[model samples]
Target: MARYVTGAPPPSLDPAVVALLEKAETATIGHWRHWGFVDRRVAPLLPRRRVAGTAFTVMLPANDGTMLAHALDHLRPGDVLVVDRLGDRRHACIGGGLAVAAQAAGAVAAVVDGPCTDLEEIEEAGFPVWCRGLAPVTTQIFDMGGAMNVPVSIGGAVVMPGDAVICDNSGVLVLPPGEAEAEARRAIETQARGAETARRVAAGELRMGVVSGATARVTGG
Candidate 1:
């Protein structure tokens, strides 16, 4: 047996705020010591792609996917679906059809705590998905019920609906709505500094360790 929990609609991230986050990489943001990142194993299905949007979280029961379809109705363009599989990594509750539906609904990406099926079709649909791994075993509509738009844990981080979700080849990070704007601004500045350092290095004016201050920190000089 399962239960479906419903509540008021969660807030959405402003498009400008989403754009700010999209400008920075997860690794850069994580460097600031934000711990909302999902596990490294949950990585993008394609290489060199990134996703930044508000989270639309779902909590599914083990081996059942009754609520996923219902969840799609709430998606908006630039929304990232974060699925918590209730620690059942064995079952892949998402597949090609769901991916298509998500894309059609304007979801930018999906992050699943468990495995996923239909990698080929998901890729074909150009829907970016992050998951533990690939599995031929898929879940069914058990009608057992699940939860949506609630706080759920994925990859050790509590992701609530409306939280900012940033994903790339590096990994996924969940930013609380309250912190998203400030953190994005910080990450943008860091990215600019990094770009300058890279340029200096390319011009043979700076060494990697020297530019990063690692040499000075270690040599004590």
Candidate 2:
């Protein structure tokens, strides 16, 4: 196999769609969706801000970060670097320098299937990252085999280059391009309705169970 295999980067997503998707919280989308969620293990460093972007998938071999470094150059504005660690969890591929590079290149966030280093740097850089966790050990520029712009696995989710990515405090959600707009629109509407329901409940005008049909179910039972 070639030491480094790369494919054409996926087309950038529409800014309008990304904006719409960003407004939809992952938690709200989770209510109606059961699939496409990244594994719970891949947690975020900065979870307060929500972001939506296109998936820029990369797969790396153990102890190698050559492809990742190269991938940074290819990142477009609003791209989310989706790293497939290929089962190596200890070697960190992302750090302070890469964070800045990605930021300058217009990457909104990253999702790593493994650990990363330089927690303090990442925090100071204000770069958002989601990964297995942190590690002291890191990857070197080994010319090990790797792939870019291809379908890769991250935290139990199948992510393809150019797939829609919705990330928030709750977690990361990947969806096919065709489903992003409709699903995001649904989530936004649901959240709006949920707010009104909460408002009524808070005003003592309604009960939680009643709004959710739980009261009727229990009463009939």
Candidate 3:
């Protein structure tokens, strides 16, 4: 029932990985597709808790327990289960059982760009799942999907196996491998600058001078 390969590297490096991290500040998964991450139309089928973990991608069409079981065994703590259903929201490829298995193996959460079932069961397990839709139908184990340890596309963005995935109430964001340090630093600095501006605003800092330049920088005016 395995559809893809795991442990094997991707054919080539994704050119978009670099730019994806560059635009990390504004990248979000919502209305627009191909922002800075994959557009897995996933809803939290399990729980509404926050999810932060390294991504382990699975490609559908050639995947099954043989591959998933191995992937689970190999995955370390702080990992997120990323499954690419090839944009197919027809059936529930993953559900509660898989969530339980993944959690037992130390998975932080799961992200599926396809349909998912067993919402109640998953929620009870306290596993965070972001999926496209909900359904009881599952794949026929046709070896169509596989567990690939390479970069795979879900929604519209490419997710490398080791990238960091952060999901919250706002939306989901993917950070390319090794880019977390720099991105986090920049985000912190920008947030500090914003906080300072907020303080000034409370102290009567008007748009005449203080806020005008900042506005221009953000708006290109």
For lDDT, the strongest prediction is: 2
By lDDT, the better pick of 1 and 2 is 2
Give per-residue CA lDDT, model 2, range 30-133, as digits (tens). 99899999998888976658899999999999999999999999999999999999999889999999999999999999999999889889999999999988
Say which candidate scores most in TM-score. 2
Alpha carbon RMSD to native, model 2: 1.1
Name model 2 segments beyond 4 Å from true. none
Question: Between the candidate structures 2 and 3, which one is better when assessed by TM-score?
Answer: 2
Residue 101 accuracy (lDDT) in model 3 = 86
Which pairs clash inside model 2? none
RMSD, every candidate, angstroms: 1.4, 1.1, 6.3
> How many pairs collide in each candidate, listed in order?
0, 0, 25
TM-score of each prediction? 0.95, 0.97, 0.72
Candidate 1 lDDT tens digits, 1-221: 56798655577899999889888788998886768988898887778476699898898987888888888887888889899999988889889999999999999999999999998899899899999988888788888888988899998998988899988899999989999999989999999999998999999998999877899999996
Order of quality (lDDT): 2, 1, 3
Identify the superior model by TM-score, candidate 1 or candidate 2: 2
Query: Model 3, 105-196: lDDT tens per residue?
Result: 88777888887788888878887888886887776545444655777787677788777776654456776657655664565466567678
lDDT of each: 0.88, 0.92, 0.64
Which structure is stronger by lDDT: 2 or 3? 2
> Global lDDT for candidate 3?
0.64
